[model samples]
Target: MRQSYQDWKGQSIEAKRSQLRGETKDLPVPVHIQKEPPFWDVFPENPEVFKLVVQARALGVLRLEENRNTEEKVIRYTRETVIGSENVEIASSWEEAVQVLEVLACRPDKEAIGRQVSAKLADADQAQDKLGLYDQFINYLKQREAELEKIGGSDSPDYKREATIIKDLITSENLQLDNKSKLSVIQLVISPEKPLVDFIEEPHISNISPVEPPFMAGANVFCTECGEQNPARSKFCYNCGTRLVKPN
Candidate 1:
């Protein structure tokens, strides 16, 4: 399997690009690692493998895998990394990938473990744009909200609330956004066209209310509990220890 992967790896990103353009239908795997399923799982359900792919891209090399046969479950991951080569099968399920990545993590430095974690944490550019994606999602919510307002929808208490939050986030930029909420929003946005009624239900992650960790500083993210102003990078309120919004 490793040898097969090695053979498929192109000499350069351009080479991979050419291959992607030609046959494999090469998809862009961004630096932002996805936590939820499908859009996250569409690439690799395993966080470990997903994280590794993110690191590889940062290092100027990224593996572009081709699953030619879905039935056979063959995942040919041709690494596109600064280094010469590396490959690992993420397995059929996330649980399986965890086992796979765990084994790889224990191997010598030559193994893919160290190389994966050593890369830079994804920024706004390299990683998937959760905010930008949410922007589209907010638009969807707004449309839904407008429709609901017409009917006096009972399910979604105030669709405008999410819109207000999203609007505030757009202007202020320092607001503490929840990561799980971001995932939930993204999931709902691209989801398989659910009923308007189903859509009205509050997002799953919104209930969890996990605080979003900020990508950058300079903005002030407030605490959910005490409403204390905290830095964008602050995970908890200095005074309240409450989860800060936007990002920690």
Candidate 2:
């Protein structure tokens, strides 16, 4: 009366399908058994690693721009770190990019201070070299004493007259004696004149193009008046003016 279990299990696949069709002839198909779409088809693939690439570019200290399908975004960075500020849009040329970076790097932080200090130091050095002040002063005094002797000979009736003449000679000639000559002239005036006889060369008094006074002889000032020369620091003219011309 009842179907044998072995008979049901032994049926061929087609026989089982026929029997299942006969049993479910009046039932609708099951919803759970319906086929599902493949996993790859459901999730689309992304070709680019945009976020990771942006971070990598910043590590290299490069500013970059990414052009998406409909819009563009800029990324700015420096050698030390990425700048979080808004991205700057500029010309796309390589030369323009390089120029902008160079300008930023080369800009001085303290523009005025740096320039002012540099100019002042340059001026001071120029003044020191141009004047040769110390050397000139020593030479001037020595030449003055020699001039005093030439015109007065220590006992001339017009000592002032000789001094005045020496001063005129110094101013007009523009005599620029070296260190050695200045010392020799000083010796000639202070020591016995016989030893320095050769040093004296008839006082080469030539007319300078432009006549000037207070010609420096050696270590003294030759007076334009009275022909009497005096020490370099003399306040008054030895033979005339109570006040001497101040040495510059």
Candidate 3:
């Protein structure tokens, strides 16, 4: 990935212009590093492996393998860091790692773990895809909240509130940090067929609401047609009376 970036950067302005015009071969795009289930979910079980992976990410080399013949299932990871190439083993196999990661990715506790890992990343760009993960996590919690309501029967209102709090944290912070990240999450979570500007202008359809209007600090419904911004909870635009949209 580093070599690809360097090669692309080495090209002259005329070469890039020719490539963009389809008069030359396409320029190489830098490959981004992303974990299948996100490292935060399973790595919490093996801090040592997680630390090494974090360090390795800075050097742009990371590989994972299943460790066989161990008393317990284990995962072996090889990473290239400033010191050199290093191999480390965690007490979980690839399959076991996948299972734990799947569970945590769906659980509300993932928000806490994801935040910590996102904070520790040496390259913030590596975490750009995390908004999609948080989007999926929020959706999972939303479904779970409804399931808890049905199962807990009116006896446990507070039980499902925990899900709401976590969802808010993801929506209000994690998913809102960068517009590019938000747009990426929208493309992955929302209907990709929809125009990005349509979602940006009408964030209620973006699945990450209530979105605060740019002119103000708090959530508001901005009317694209009439140019009126209403309070977050308002169902219709107070000025134009256009019905405000909300995520299903």
Q: Against the unseen true structure, what C-alpha lDDT does each candidate score?
A: 0.42, 0.35, 0.44
lDDT per residue as tens, model 1, 115-148: 4433322333311354554445455565656668
For each candidate, give its TM-score against the true structure.
0.23, 0.14, 0.26
RMSD (CA, Å), each prediction:
20.8, 39.5, 19.9
Error of 3 at 169 (Å): 6.8
Write candidate 3's Cα lDDT for 109-202 as tens digits: 2233344444533233333555544555555555545656766832465434445445454554454445545655545554433333332334
Instruction: Evaluate model 3: give its TM-score.
Output: 0.26
For model 2, the stretches where C-alpha displacement exceeds 4 angstroms are 1-59, 67-75, 78-85, 89-91, 102-248
Q: How far is candidate 2 from the true structure (C-alpha RMSD, Å)?
A: 39.5
lDDT of 3: 0.44
How many angstroms is residue 240 displaced in model 1 relative to the true structure, after the best TM-score fit? 40
For lDDT, candidate 1 versus 3, the one ahead is 3
lDDT by residue (1-248, candidate 2, tens digit) is: 11232132223222433443455332223222334312212222221222122122222223455635325444333221165533233213322332222222222311222343234324433323222422343344344345456665445534443344434433443344444445454554543412321222334533212112354768676556565666786655545444455456
Q: What are the clashing pairs of model 3?
A: 74-92, 75-92
Better of 1 and 2 by TM-score: 1
